[model samples]
Target: MKKVFCIGELLIDFVAEKQGSDLSKATYFTKKAGGAPANVACAIAKLGGRSVFIGSVGDDPFGTFLLDVLRENRVDVSLAQRTETFTTLAFVSLAENGERDFVFSRGADKELQYNSAIKSEFAGNLIHLGAATALLGGKLEEAYGHYFFDGLTKKSFISFDPNYRADLWKNKQQNFAKKCMTFVEKADLCKFSLEEAQLLSGKEDVAEACRFLHEVGTNIIAVTLGASGTLISTREFQETVPSIKVKAVDTTGAGDAFIGCLLQQIAALTNTDSLAGDRDLLVSMVAKANKAGAITTTNYGAIESLPDQEQLSA
Candidate 1:
């Protein structure tokens, strides 16, 4: 199988299961290995796919835990960097029905920057961007180019997940929408939550939003809709795949797992790059991905609850 190169943040998530969303009245936060890209890498590894993660973490207990989780799941961490900065932390609030809200305390994840190694590793790999940290500026934005746009464009296929979080962009740049569209245009396959697709395309209709994205240059667009299922569209055909119902638990990392599962099949398949003409194959891939995502809600934590190949095959 070809390797999937995941770029972005790795953080420690502090989760709390409460009777209600009112964290002010209730109590307790459970620490877990979180962060979207990190969870995606773990999901890939657990499904018997190869994934390598590149990012920076602090020299702290949280970082140690994050690294241990990734290594335990069989992810290659050679490109991960360590510094003295404090590790990033997210406080997750989950409701009884499995819906979630987050309070993030950005730390070392913001410090991940460009390096020559990203270019060297880009060839023949499927690159995934988005994990809360990739949108940060400074050397990191430049690094995105060295790897995705410039260095490896000719050799590898690109996949993107905007994973937009409204909370993080409040104090940032004036051109946030512009930056997102720029990256969307470069991806071969891209997935976004319905909320993210609207935010990026400025179109409320999911299909219209996806159409705009494709017109702008994204080849394959998949928009996730919680339990209702996923909307998959290529330049050829579009379909909505209904999700397999499951007992709900934690909503965290479900979308990331969906992306991971999709990439797992793509990287393992020889015709992955030619997804446009293979409508039937594409539909099946998205349907399988939808199942992987729905199953994630049946468990807790991102990495801890990811379904393995045996469970998936069964």
Candidate 2:
């Protein structure tokens, strides 16, 4: 199977132990290795798929911990960088139902410098742009654009997930959506949360939103609807696959798990011709991905909650 390349931030998430929306009132925080891309890479690795993570962390102990977590999970970290700046930190506040609010302290993640040396690695593989901070600007943004075109030129399957976070954007939300659309236009596969789909397409209906994105050029679009399930759309197929029932504790890594599983399955396929035309196969893959995601919610933390092949089969 071709390895999935995940590019973006690798940081520490300080999650509140108590379930509530208030971060200020929470007296305790549990640190975990977290970042959308890093979580996806770890998810793929845990499921017995090869994955490589490309991002930056600080030269601090927190960065060391994050790298160790990735390595332990079997994700390749050869391309990961260490910066002099402090590692990025996100404070997560969770509601009783697993809803989360985040406050970010931008750090080394934003300092990721562009390196053209890795461009050849994009050839004939899958590269997932899962960054929440990559689009926010700086050298990471430059790297994102450079690698995206390189992947395209090399006939790579380009996947993108904007992984939109409101707190991170603040007043720059419009810029986020606009910049994300550029990626949406070029991506072979794109994943979006319900809110992100609506905001980007300016459509109330999920189908219409997906249609707008399709018109903009993404060959396949998967819009995640928190509890309902995931809506998947391509030129020849569209369907809403229902989610598995589970008692969700933390939803932080659920979406990552779903996409990771889906991408892994896609990467494992020897016959790429069926990917666009096989509706039943696609639905089945999404169903399996749903189960993977559902299973993730039964546990706490991102990487820790991710299921292995045996766990997924069970």
**Which candidate number has the best lDDT?**
2
lDDT per residue as tens, model 1, 63-89 = 998998899999999988887889988
What TM-score, to 2 decimals, does candidate 1 have? 0.95
How high is the CA lDDT of each candidate model?
A: 0.83, 0.89
Candidate 2: residue 119 Cα off by (Å):
1.2
Clash total of candidate 1 = 0
- In model 2, pairs of residues that clash are none
Lowest-lDDT window of 10 residues in candidate 2?
A: 269-278
Q: How many clashes show up per model? A: 0, 0
Evaluate model 2: give its TM-score.
0.98
Candidate with maximal TM-score: 2
**What does the lDDT read for residue 185 in candidate 2?**
92
